[model samples]
Target: MSTYKKYFAAMALIWAGCAVVIILAYLLLFAPQSRRRLQTENQLKETKRAYRAGLKAGQKDAQDLAREQIQQMQHGLANFVTDAESSANLIFDLSQIANARQLDSFTIKAKDDREKSEMSDYKNIGENHIDVSFTGDFNQFATFLNAMERHQPVIFVDQFKITRPKRQGTANNVNMSLAVFVRKNNES
Candidate 1:
C-alpha cells in the first residue's frame, strides 16, 4: 500500500507540471499575435481618417478656384458693355455737318476692313469716308472745309476737286467734289 501511494503521488505531480507548461505556451504565442492584430487595426483606422481629411480639403480648393474664375469673367463683361454703349452714342450730327460744308449731294461710303488687302491690320477699324458733291462758289467750299477742320472730332478730307460749269446756263455754279473721312471712337 505504501508503494502504490508513492506512484499515485508522482503521477499527479507530472500532470500538474504538464498543465502549467501548456498555459505558458498558449500565453507566449497567442498574446503577441493578438496584440499585433490590434495595432494593425488602429493603423488602418488612422490612415482612412487622414485620407478623408485630404479629400475634403481638395474639394474646397476646387470650388474656390471656380468661383474666382466666374467673378473675373463677369467683371470683364461689364467693362465691355460700358465701352460699347459709349461708342454707340458717338455719331456726329449729320445735318449740321452738311450745312457747314455747303454740301448739295452728300453720300457716305462705309467699307469694312474685310475688303482691305491686309485684312488683319484693319479688323478693328470703323472708319467711313463721305463723298460730297455740291454746286457752290469757291468761298463757300473753303468755309465748309474750314468748319470741318475746327470741329471737335476731327474730320480728314483727302480728295478735293472744283470745276467751272461746262454749260453756258450753269455759269454761276461751280461743281465741287470732296472726300471727308470720319473715325468712330471705340475707346470711350
Candidate 2:
C-alpha cells in the first residue's frame, strides 16, 4: 500500500477506539443512573394513586358514621315520646278501671316496698306499689279484674282477696282487697 493510505487507516482506527471507550463508559455509569430515575418515577405515580384511593375510602366512612348517628338520635326521641304518652294513658286507664268495676268505695294506697334495712323496714328506692280496696259483689270484682287485664296500660295484679264483711251484722256487703303494680310517677 502507499504511505497516504496507511496514514488514513491509522486515523480511522484511533477514532473507532475513542468511540468504543465513550460507549463503554456510558454503559457502566450513566445507564444504571437512568434506570434508577425511571424506577423512582414509577414509585411516585403508584403513591399518588394510593393516596387518592385512601381519601375516597375515608370520605365514605365519614358519611356512613354520620347517618348512623342521626338514626340513633331519631330512635331515642321516638322512645321518649312513647314513654310520655304511655304514662298519661296509664293514669286515665286506672280511673276507668275504678268506674267500670262498679266498686262501692275504692281506696288506692301507694306504699314503697323497697327495704332499707331488716331492722327498720325503710325503703331505699322509695318507689310505691298500689293497693285497691273496695266493698263489692263477686261478679263486680271479676269484671274489674278482667277490665284491668284488657286495659291498654300495663297493670300487674300481684295479690287479691275476697272475704265476708266482719262487723256487727252486715251480711249484704263483702270486703275485697286488690294489690296491683302501678308505674312510678317519676318514671320516664
Candidate 3:
C-alpha cells in the first residue's frame, strides 16, 4: 500500500478500537450500575409503603386497646354499687362482721341518696349514705374498719366520732357515716 493509505488505515483501525472500548465500558459499568440503582429505588418505595401500612394497623390496634380498657373500667365501676336488695344484704353483712369482731353493739341505717350535679361526668350517679354505730374495743374497731374496707359494694367512710367510756372495762363507742355510689333508678 502507499504511505498515505497506510496512515489512513491505521487511523481507521484506532478509531474503531476506541469505539469498541467505549461500548464495552457502557455495557460493563454504566448499564449494570443504572439497573442496580433502579432496583434499589423500587425496594425503597416498597419498604415505605409497608411501613405506612404497618403504622395504620398499629394505630387501629392502639385505639381498639384503649376502647377495650375503657369498657373494662366501666364494668368494674358497675360492680362497686349496690341495689336495694344488695343494700339490705350489705347491712346484714356489716352486722355479721360486727358480731364476728365481738363488738358490744352495732347498728346500720340507710339514709336518703344524694343527687349528683348535672355538670359532673357521673350525672346519673347518687350517693347512698349509711349511718353506722358500734361499741367495741380498739382492736375490734380496727378489725371492723378493715372488714368494711374489704367488703363488697365498696364502702367509703364519710365521717366518724369516737368516744371512750368512763369505765376502763366498758367498750369505746363509735359512730360512723359511710357512703357508696349508686346509679339512680329513675333518670330525671
Candidate 4:
C-alpha cells in the first residue's frame, strides 16, 4: 500500500517481463539457428565419412601391394596371365610334368572351368586353383613337385596328401591342391 513498496513491485515486474522477452527472443531466433548448426554438423560428418570410405575404396593398401609385388618377383615371370587362355597352359604344363614323371592315374581338374572370379583382390592379377592327383612312388612324386616348383613362372603347391592304395604295391596315391597366381597384364 506504501508508495515505495508499490514502486519496488513495479520494478520487479518489469525486470521479470524483460527476462521473459529475452528468453522468448532466444527461443525464437537462437534456437532455430542452433538446430540448423547441429544439422549442418551432422551433414558434414556424414560427408566426411563418405569421403573417407571412397578414399579407402579407391586406393590399394601399400603393404598388401608390396606383398603382391614380392610374390610376382618370386614367380620369375610377372606376365604370367592376361586372361583365362593365358593361364590355360598351367594345366598343360602340369600335364607335361606328370608325363615326364610317368605318374599313373595322373589326373588334373580345374576347380572352375571358367575365368577367374571377381573375388580376386587385384584387377590385373588373377588366381586359379586346380586339383591334381597322381599315382607314383614317393621319389617320383617328389621329383614331380620339384619340377612344378621349378617351372618358369613358378606354381604354388598349396598342399599334397599321400596315401598308399591297398591294391598298388609300392605306388602311392598323391592328391595335390595347387594355387596359381598370374598377372592379367603382360607389363610384368
Measured by TM-score, the strongest candidate is 3
Candidate 3 Cα errors over 4 Å, as ranges: 1-67, 113-122
Clashing residue pairs in candidate 1, if any?
none
**Per-residue lDDT of model 2, residues 54-166, tens digit only:** 78657978678878999998675443223433543554566678787667776665445644523243322212245667777677877877887665433556567777777
Structure candidate 2, residue pairs in collision: none
How much is 144 displaced in model 3, in angstroms? 0.4
Runs of candidate 2 exceeding 4 Å displacement = 1-92, 116-128, 167-188
Question: Is 2 or 3 the stronger prediction by TM-score?
Answer: 3
Instruction: Work out the TM-score per prediction.
Output: 0.36, 0.38, 0.58, 0.51
lDDT tens per residue, model 1, 62-155: 6788789999986754432223233322234434665666566544433333234322344343434344556666667777667766654445
| Candidate 1 vs 4: which has more lDDT | 4
TM-score-wise, the better of 1 and 3 is 3
Q: Write the per-residue lDDT of candidate 4 for residues 87-185, one digit (tens) a residue.
A: 788889899888888889899998877465564667667778889998888899889988976775657787889998888476888999887776666
lDDT of 3 by residue, 5-29 (tens): 9999999999999999999999999
TM-score for model 4?
Answer: 0.51
**Model 4 bad stretches (over 4 Å):** 1-83, 113-119, 185-188
Full ranking by lDDT: 3, 4, 2, 1
The residue pairs in collision within model 3 are: none
**Model 3 misses residue 92 by how many Å?**
1.6
Relative to the true structure, how large is the alpha-carbon lDDT of every model? 0.57, 0.62, 0.82, 0.81
